[model samples]
Target: MRSWAEAERAEVGRARLRVSVLVALAIALMIAFVGGIAYVVMVHAQETQVSRELRYNARYGVPGIAPRCAWVFVLEDGTLHEGDLEVPRGFPLRDDIDAVHASRGSIERDVKANGTEYMVLTAPGADGTTVQAVFDLRYQLLDRAHLLLALAIALVAGLLLAALVGLTISRRTVGPWAEALARQRRFVTDASHELRTPIARAHLRAQVLAAGLPADQRTDLDALARSIRGLADVVDDLLASAQLQERRDRVPVDLTDVAEAAVVGETERATERRITVLLDHPGRPVLVGGIETGLRRAADELLANALRHTPEGGRISVSVRTVAGQAELVVADNGDGFHPAEAERLFERSHRGPGEGRFGLGLALVREIVTGHGGTVEAVGRPGAGARFTLRLPLAEAGLPVGGEHMTGACP
Candidate 1:
């Protein structure tokens, strides 16, 4: 049994380790790639410099061509004499050489003689004439070695900085999610406790009503029944919302059919209120991927909310239309609209305005349903002006006829 925090940290650590290893490998490869190229280029440049120096020296010998010079040995054959010139200190000189010979052509090679190394360039001058130029690359080698070391240091520093930045970003990003999870757990606990109380009270009230009381108990029983219903409705809404949030996949829904069903249900309930229902765009079905029950619930909540707020005889209009690959469900009424102060918090769970026994969960449920369907619900109404609730759903498929006869019916 691993603690949640420990498990999360371990997971994060593993992820960070994986990312760091990949980044380190990439950085190492990059450095090696660049360093290998630089080494090759530097070696080539040093060789070029040595060749250029040799050419300059070959043109002018001794002190004028080179600052340091030395004579090592002499050789003779027949009527000519030849000698070897030692390279200056810190300059490359032939360390491996065969016996100096007087011949028609010249030979050049890097040789070690007497434990000293040299780069010797030899060529024929005239008939039986030979010359050699020697140079050392100790200083060039040391400079290249230092440069490679510096580049490696810089590369390591850059990799460390990148790792630090990555770690910081991961921590910052996951912090909010951790806090939200904790809050959600608390909310669930609180909601469960709240649910238990109402249910228990409703059960007690039901038992009392079932005990066969007198007429005096009728009013109390009715109030208890209303409370029980309200509690049940809230519980049902909470469960539905949770299910919607947890939905992993979506399916296409016919908006026109869903709208007709919602309107019909609201109409039945609004019979006592005498709210007029106006249905527009009665010929076409607009299809989109959304939960039918959620959509219908949202629509009903909007219509019922309107009827509740609107005065009797006030015109309540419901319209559905398809436009530009989207379906719009608009519900409006001719009554004083929402107050400015409540506009921002209208869709927040359990927030209500100035009204008796008004639990502010209806609009919140509406918002949840619309959001779960991958759509947007907006309220555009000002104080003293009739409010409009607009639901937008994406239309299904391409070039579908907006006037298909599949959509037909008024709210029940």
Candidate 2:
């Protein structure tokens, strides 16, 4: 648990970091998009210019006087005349020349040879022959390569510069949020802590009175005691929710370990009610980045909720594993299932269902904690069926080395 002052610092630090990262990402994406467009336009223009040069050399140039980096060949009267220059090994594409001569149609294609690309065109000549033109594309290819390298360098520099700019901007942009969080969190934590003792005392006194009263007269007193205890639980949950923003001591924790621990904690309760508690976890760790205490609370809340709703002798299943790159913990119970419509509403603060002796704060607190760890929680259930609660957290970079502690039991 973090003190109010430490929580304030963590919240402010996170706010600034979030703003800085978002700004840097935005600028980096913009740079990449603009660079891509420029690269595309340059490539298109170069291709068009190369095609024009090939056409021009094919039409006007003689065999020996072809343009630089270009060769011209003429086939006339079934005799081939090559340029005086040393022809490339694959010159005068014979197939294209024969095809053009026979069909009297133009054939244009790109060919790669000699470690470079060539733009080749064989067309019917006005002088009763076939003319072939080849243009070496090495220089153009080199230019494009250079452009790509330049863009890569620019992108890297832009990212660094954007990060620096973001850092400078975030200090000012996150000021209001920092102050607001400090003020609000300080009050919530303080008030919740202050009220907890008195509430606990009142609850204890009511319980004693209800225990001593005659059975018929003690009904309302027991209800009052229960309500007071519920109030204490709410206050405790609020305190936990307020403290969840602390980013300190966030380490890679085994989600399987957390889930198993939660299940073990509820085992006594389950057995007392003749309910069976089953835990199924992987042999290896399902690691997630989070404050272990908060993550444990989230797991515990789900299991406790399942136990509370499940009827005596009913079963509860707790599972932890890696799913879709996330560490997932699921708690399911075959007890008093809720209506499907209330699945979403169950997490709303203060929303109470019929016969539910809670203020709907536990699941909400669990959601808040999981969300703070960059995770998600969901509820699924149907009337007369069972309810399932799943919690998912982004997996950490493989788990840190921790002593092996595991539990596994299949649920019937």
Candidate 3:
């Protein structure tokens, strides 16, 4: 399973891909729209030029012009007079001439004769005669075909170039996000390492001083020691959360033993607070595959969180069992419970609820450890009622049993 950071990077890549595709589509549509307008303008211009040349030939006949426009003159009595211009064979026949003469006003029309296209124009001559002129449209049609072909090639080339440029821009745009994430991870790792040394030295010095103190001073020294321990625990949690991405070593672990050992370790703290800590289990081994140290730390954090919240005389319970091919650990505490609205945010880093003397790192560490093991952790609670944290991890294969004795260890 990919880590959350890796999954986020993948999602960014997908978003970049979507942006590139949209950009390419926009470029393609723009080219098509512009190309269509240019095509229409060019066709209209060609038609207008053809009509102008036909009208000119009708009024003042050109003799033997290139590709020859045919001309005819009709008197008021409807007598036909063919002009000096030579009409092509099977073109501008008598019926075409009559249609042109019968037109009421100056107008242009297209006619096809013997597989050839012609643009015809009709107008009244200065001498009370009707004039008609026809020009061949083959060359104009061929030019339009070439223009369309050129536009198509341009459209394809433009689309490909747009796609290439879009891909490059997308990569450049997402690069900063990747760099920022890398820097954040590095800072967390370096800062956590730097903090561990001083905390360890302070904890050591406190232990020594507490050992030498007298009975009356011993309580104050012990309290100081506990405070130092809590600080160390925070440092450890920060280090573990930072290093989770780097730790992938897995082994078969007995969760039942881990839960029992975590309970034993917190027994002193619970007793001091007058809270009842109960370990409920069938004593049967529950096997899971994960990092044993990380799993133990997760269990410890859960237990610590429960102990910290439970009031004096309140009950805390820890249990481990296997259900539906998964190993489950449940930690419940009867204390001033949290609001249901805040339950989901309880495991977020550095988020504190309505409580005093809370560092807010315990539940976050537990969430990180369990998630690193390809497991899930959830909290459920109602105000003034109680809170339950449940963790579910995939069980190891039945034949790959790890002994509980090997899994027994003190929580960090």
Candidate 4:
């Protein structure tokens, strides 16, 4: 399974690839459309110029005026009239002359002979004769071919340029997200490290004071010790969650053992709070491939969250089982639940409920750890009812015996 960072990078790469492809396609299409229109307009203008020159040569009888223009005069009886203009051979044929005479009006057509193209025009002459003019289209056709080649080259270059630009834009857009994630991870690591010294000193000082204090003053010291331990746990969670993002090791870990261990770890806190904490699990192991330490921290976070929310005398249960080839670890608490709409948001960093007395990183850390393991975690509950957090992980193919034991501990 891919780590969280790897998965996020993959998603970003896919998005960038899509954007680049779309941008290049759009640019290529626009270039092709514009080039096509320009080509048509240019070709039409050249053709119009040829036709106008033909008309001018026929009317003015310009001799040797244009090399490619050929004109001949023919009588109404379909007999050719030799004129001053030198007509090219194989042009304005007898058939063409006859067709003009039959029409008895202006006629325009294209003629191809000996692999050469010509635009021909026929009109009635002044003395009851017909005049036919032809213009060569070879140069114009060559010009059009050149235009097509240029357009193709421009299209290819434009697509390449657009692809480069699109890739640059995509990287620029996604760079900040990667940087922010890195900075957050760094902050978590730094903060966790910075907090350890003070937390250890406080814990040691509290222990010394509790040892020296009389029985009457011991209760307050114990409470202080608990609060310090909770802070230390929070610090440890912060560090673990930050490191989990980069953790790539995986092994067959029995979630049952992780869950049972978490419940056993929280027994003292549950007893102090006067809350009933129960652990229910199948006798068999529920194996999953993941970082055992991270999974244990996730289970610990869930149980800690429940212990925090549940009221005195309220019930909290941690259950582990397998369902449909998936390992499920569920933590349910009969506490003052949050608003239904806020269930999803509760897992966001630093998001705390009213009077929850938490920094709100526990659930967020749990979610991060679970997702890094290719698993999912969700919360469900309503105000005045209980809350249930379910975590599901893909189960290993075969159950890996882990400690070969089960925890059925319930603290009163």
Tell me, by TM-score, which candidate is best.
Answer: 4
Predicted structure 4: lDDT: 0.78
lDDT of each: 0.62, 0.82, 0.74, 0.78
Candidate 4: residue pairs that collide: none
lDDT of 3 by residue, 1-412 (tens): 3443565567778978887888899888998999899889989998889877887777786334434445544434577665456667754455655655676466667888756688877666665666667788878888888988998998899889988988988888877876787677668768877877777777678778888878778876676765666556555545554553643335688888889878877877889899888888777878788766667778988888787778888999998888787899999999878899898898888888665667888888788778877899999998778899999999876565453322111112
**Candidates' RMSD to native:** 13.2, 10.9, 8.2, 7.8
lDDT of 1 by residue, 1-412 (tens): 1223444456556766666666666766777788888888988898787767766554444432353432222122323222344435433322222222334344556555544545566544433334456655556667788988988897788678767755666556656765675566457546854675657566566756746777776765655564454455444444333331333234556777766766776665566777787878658666776555556667778888888878877778888898777789999888779776667688898787676478889988787667656678888777878888898877655543333221111100
Where does candidate 3 clash, by residue pair?
none
What residue runs in model 4 are displaced by over 4 Å at the alpha carbon? 1-141, 155-248, 265-278, 303-317, 333-362, 379-387, 397-412
Q: What is the full ranking by TM-score, best candidate first?
A: 4, 2, 3, 1
Q: Higher-TM-score candidate among 1 and 3?
A: 3
| TM-score attained by model 1 | 0.43
TM-score-best of 1 and 2: 2
lDDT at 142, model 1: 75
